[model samples]
Target: MSRRPFLTLPNSHFFLASRAAAVVTTLAAALVAVSVSAPALAQNTPASSAAAVTGGAATYDTAGASAVQPDDTNNFDARQKDLDRRSTDNNYRYAVAEHDCYSKFFVNHCLDSARNEMREKRAVIRKEQLALDDEQRAARAQKRDEQAALQRAQDAADAPQRAANDARNAQAYQDKQRQHALDQAQRTAEAPQRAANEQAYQQKQRQHALDQAQQGIGASQAAANQKAYDQKQANFQQQLDAARQQGAQKAQQRVENQQHFEQKQATAAQHKADVEARQKQAAEKAREKQQQQLQEQQQQQQQIEQQKQQGK
Candidate 1:
């Protein structure tokens, strides 16, 4: 045991050296771990701070490469919208704003200028739409006018034809009436003349019979007076016969005269009827002309209204 004690001291020294080496290696490893963890902590601290500041929400960046504050971006968008609203409201306010310090003419000019500027802007847009509307309206108007013109032309053209046809019809009717009148007159004249001729012929026959009776009576008388009576009776019979014949001839002449008078009356009546018919036709034509003139006046009034509207 005394011998072992003498060598145990070196073993203890060697063991102490080994323990020290192990402690130095562990300390170096701990230092390396602390150095790596410090940079990682530093990186995490900034990210955490940024997350806290931004409320841990992702946002769109309109400004590239520029640090955009969430509040600033929201405020900027709100301000832009407010400015747009103000600009719109200002336009209306400007329209009503009074510039009493300036002369009336100047103030009016200023307001008018502003209004004109606004109007010009609106007019540019309206002009395009108005042009299209006007084109459509003009096309419709043109079509309507063309249709109206065509109708007028047709009416005008037809008017003469209708008048001509009416005239012809009126003339034809007058001619028919005149012919009827003439025929009636001729019938009336012929009836009287025929009756007179028949009466005359009957009278002549009666007279001839009376003359023969007288002659027979004379023959029956006594022989001494017979010759004288016969001569006297013969002379009387001849005279009576001649008178009857003369009367018959006169009757025939009167009948001819009556027929001629009736023919003249028929011709006069036909002529009068024709003249009346022509006068009626002329009146109708005048009426038609008046109607045409009235239509033209109406068309002229429409044209005047259209012109007034265009001026407006």
Candidate 2:
């Protein structure tokens, strides 16, 4: 009888075969799982957010073309906040999906799908964010334009007043220029008087020097000059005192006249008011008496009609 030889493979080869079978099984499972869940994950905020991104595309450009209306501004913050939350949530879900892919056989495809979904959500959020920003900017610009228009209208309305003020200022400036011209002419006219005064001052100084030289000639002449100077000073002081007294008297007289005028005005106004009050009272009494008499006449006529009807 012939003995049959049993052919055996190496342990490593069997191990490799088993590992490859397990890898194939895992790959199929991962593909099925990803196929089922990729849509769900992509659709996390997809339906409504996608609609918003599409609809708001028009609004984003509308602000540049026409103007943003009040309706477009409604729920702006709420919509933006929703987008922001979705963006954050989308990134977190991608992280989770990517982490799950590491344990699976095909990590690259899983990561690629997660990244694509995250980008799609980000694009949606970016579009909505851009739309909100455009809307806010348009509203601010419109308000600024309206305010500027109102300011221009106000300036237009005040144009006449401003022109009148400018004209008055010009007249005042002309008056000031005329006054300055007059002052200059007066200064020119005073030049000769100033020269004469300077000449007189020079003559007085020469006379004073001559007097001093004469005083040096005799002590008696010096004493006479001193007496004359004392007399002049006394006379000047008396004149100044008298002038001050006169000024005080004039000021007191003016004050008395003003007080007297005020009293007279007050008295006259009070008398006029009293006369008016009396006239008003008399007129009011006469009107009341006339009204009472008219009412009594009407009542008597009504009674007479009643009596006639009773007789009939």
* Candidate 2: tens digits of C-alpha lDDT, residues 52-98: 23344532221122333566556665555554545445555665676
lDDT of 1 at 209: 57
lDDT of 1 at 192: 87
Model 1 alpha-carbon miss at residue 268, Å: 29
RMSD of 1: 38.9
Clashes in predicted model 2: 0
Q: Estimate TM-scores for all models.
A: 0.24, 0.38
Steric clash pairs (candidate 1):
none
lDDT of 1 at 92: 34
lDDT of all predictions: 0.50, 0.59
Model 2 clashing residue pairs (backbone): none
| Top candidate (TM-score) | 2
